[model samples]
Target: MLKSALVFRNAFKILKTKYLPYTKELQKVGGALDDEDWDKIASFLPFRQIFYDSTLSFFGSRYVTGNTFVEEIYDIGYRINRSIDDLNDGVKSMARQMKMKFDKY
Candidate 1:
């Protein structure tokens, strides 16, 4: 019970520190976000690493005797998903900027 509670607490901390800033800033700026804004968004993660915070959060769950096939597959999928998410977010911001820039012409 305590472990679960601690996990939840840690998850919430990760959400606030690692996830919320980018989203909140995006919302706050509407579509006028700039490169500096994205840089600030990226800065939330340690060393700007993909899934660094999330992977650390699951440190206790890492394989002790080498990962099973299922674990290996899940890890692959998780990494792909994280990469896609990061790309998607950045692309969305860039798309907005492009649209706004072209609109002025």
Candidate 2:
């Protein structure tokens, strides 16, 4: 019973991560700069192609160059996402193997 419960818990953890938010690239495309210097802002960001409209106005470049709150949040998001992905994969594999072993009985 304890093992089965643990398996269920593991399954839940994996499901959580597989459904986590993933939009760094998507959000970056809608930013405020057409990039007379694309390499400057986007080289660090996780994106392949950047798109900017005429209505966009480039900022004075603070998020990439300071200890700002937005930067902190972005850092936290990336860290949390990585850790959760690792944890989730382990849990899911464990759950699957446990179930498969039990099914033979």
Candidate 3:
């Protein structure tokens, strides 16, 4: 949730600094730019391309991989939860070890 928020905030910043300026310049030219022209302008902004690619990959994977994409996301979530569980277990194990060592002394 926090990560998504940061991504949106950064995307907005890029839009403000890069894309908005280009758009204002286009408006000043006194005519509407068509889809193709807008695409051309967007292509020149490297950050826009990167942002679009990342966002598309996240939401478009389903279109490319069908149902497997959903399974993949579930697997990733499970692994993350497992990793947190393992870390917690490790801390308990270490505390047990310390307790045993002190008891022996």
Candidate 4:
């Protein structure tokens, strides 16, 4: 979970600083990204091509390569962070329950 959070943070940072500004122009391409644009996106992702292909497959044919790719990244990051927060909250709740049980004993 920590590793995922770290990776998410890094990826989101890169997306915000780098690719996000180009969102309009990139989307204008209609998923016909050139090599340079592709390289820019792939450079920050772990497992580069595999990650891209898997995301495309999971999210549908062109989610990763489509005009909304940048937006997708943002959404993915938001989901990941939300999941992490939920898990953390669950853990904290469990810990509190355990403490209450021990205190009663």
Q: Top model by TM-score, which number?
A: 4
Error of model 1, residue 33, in angstroms: 13
lDDT of 4 by residue, 4-103 (tens): 5444555654564577556555566563344454443443333233346547755785335554665655554444333333324543454455445534
Q: Give the better candidate number (1 or 2) by lDDT.
A: 1
Each prediction's RMSD to truth: 14.8, 22.8, 18.3, 17.6
> Which residue runs of candidate 4 sit more than 4 Å off their true CA positions?
1-54, 57-66, 88-105
lDDT of 3 by residue, 1-105 (tens): 333434365454456466767657656776344544444344334323333554566777556564654655454444333333332454345445544553465
lDDT tens per residue, model 1, 1-105? 333433355454455466766557666758333445545454333222433543554564665444444464455344444444344466445445544543454
Model 2 regions more than 4 Å off: 1-67, 87-105
* lDDT for position 81 in model 3: 39
Candidate 3 overall lDDT versus native: 0.47
How much is the lDDT of residue 73 in candidate 3? Answer: 48
Clashing pairs in 3: none
TM-score of each model, in listed order: 0.22, 0.20, 0.23, 0.24
Least accurate 10 contiguous residues by lDDT in model 4 = 40-49
How do these models rank on TM-score, best leading? 4, 3, 1, 2
As for lDDT, the candidate ahead, 1 or 4, is: 4
- Between prediction 3 and prediction 4, which has the larger TM-score? 4
> Backbone clashes in each candidate structure, one number apiece?
0, 0, 0, 0
